[model samples]
Target: MTSPSDPIVLVGLPGAGKTTFLAALWYALNHSTDGGISLNALPEDQAYLNEISRTWRQGEPQPHTATAVFQEIRLCVRYDGADVPGELVLPDLSGECFQQDQWADRHWNQKYDSIARAASGVVLLVHPDAWKGSPRIADVARAEQLIEGSVAESQGEHVASGGAGRAGADESDQVEANVVDFDPLRVPAQVILVDLLQFLIGDPCFHTALRVSVVISAWDLLESRGRTPSVCLEKEMPLLHQFLTSNADRISCQVFGVSAQGGPYEDPRVRQNLLQMDNPIERIQVRDADGNTSDITAPILWQVRDRVVEERECRGIS
Candidate 1:
């Protein structure tokens, strides 16, 4: 199960905290990394890992990934009491590739196709504040009324002028402009995610019975309001929650609330408090469906180790 071609994939929108989570996971793995999951060997390429982890430990903000950047990370990792380590390959792709380029515009890249075909598991990240909900019924009704009034006024002008050719053309253009052009970026978060998952399941080359880790980043904001990861999913994004629940046979999922930076680093007080901590690992918090944990590797470990073992056992592999 550990190979270059078959890897666990990370998917999310820009600013969804995928990069931050990776940095925290790298830091957590190196400190008190035993008793759960630990890195067996670092990848030959440590430049990217070093840079991001440095910012994470220093309480500095991680730079947003440029849309054109696509980094593949390979970590040789092992779970406690496992016979051998597994190579966890992660493609740290730009979120735009998923939402804007692929799903929205249908500008599918062959590279993404290869990655999707070979992915063994998926970590889907979502920022709570980034959700773009569907337009309200009242708002839609109001827009329709405005368009109708404009058309009626245009018709009255046409009769008064008896041959308002240019005026009629301008009114037609206005009406056409008023007709909302679908912007792929504005598609509801849940809608895109659902469509993404459906693509995975429907595609013939992709693996079936996939395990997914739904991570809600910046969990500190929502945790303060006494919301668990599972509850947050159900309430905040019912469409995604229902889709996952309904398709339980095709995909098994676990929701995690990850506060990779503990709190927003933009806050001076928060940054100061984090800097004061002797161990920056303490600044990381991971909430499972059940409870909280300090291990930032929980989600990846579940995907690369736990599920891999389960799959092997079911096949009677000794």
Candidate 2:
């Protein structure tokens, strides 16, 4: 059975701002008492968050995470005025590693794939600025050109792209990876996501609940265009949008717009903006970006309240 400490994995492409989001979330949950939420970490892990918070205080851009390593941090949380208290084990992963898992031949082959599969929920971050056309289709075409040799070549591509398994991976693995009869090419975000959900959900007997919170980072750029998060996502990443909307029966999802750093540090008015950010009862939950208040914490709030946990209970998932 799941406990209060069940983990939530954050997935997205590189530069999705997972690192910054985690830091900001830590600060908003811990330092701010306006809300009853609390996210506590061990002293050492707490120090890391503190450093990230300091960088925000200085109005400087924090360093990016190394693509291959993630320092796992467990956060003991209490929210809803302490009505719901749980533990969230967060892995600070670079976006490359995540999309790498998404493109894998067998998702379970990816590093930390098992942990992700067993996690209670997931949060996907997408950078509003960089989210353009689908790149997976081209990646698949390249794979087709490289596949004329043998089974070994296909396995190599999956592994080199960050999936697990070595040169002589099990024959059954090859079959399992190719089970989906969809196009070998045209692996859009929708396909990757569907595969991911199918793998995580497992068979009917192994069905477990999952929550996917898609956060559009740097929302300031889009809000200026008079579009909501859903509106922009539908236009920019329609396949992903349709996938989530059409599969409501399979997974629970919520879309949110967030601006963790508000705007770039290079902006001349950044200092003034930061100064004005203070005095809010909440920490950085709400901030005035271009000219409006953006709720960076809404996704987390929705994630916490999603029905994934309820589904797990109903399905009797261990």
Error of 1 at 116 (Å): 1.8
Tell me the tens digit of each residue's lDDT in model 1 across 1-318.
433226878888788889999998888777765427788887899999889999888888898888888888988877754565767778898888888887888765677678778887789999987664565457789999998898789778887988577777887787698898778888888888898888887777654577789999999888888888999898788888999999988888999999999998889998899899998888888899658887887887676565556656766776
The count of backbone overlaps in candidate 2 is 2
Alpha carbon lDDT of each predicted model: 0.81, 0.63
Q: How many residue pairs clash in each candidate?
A: 0, 2
What does the lDDT come to for candidate 2?
A: 0.63
Once fitted onto the true fold, the runs of candidate 2 whose alpha carbons sit more than 4 angstroms away are 40-44, 81-84, 101-111, 133-199, 202-209, 279-295, 306-318
Best by lDDT: 1
lDDT of 2 by residue, 218-264 (tens): 76566678776777777777767887788777667777777777666
TM-score of each: 0.83, 0.68
User: What lDDT score is found at residue 86 in candidate 2?
Assistant: 71
Candidate 2: residue pairs that collide? 4-87, 109-164
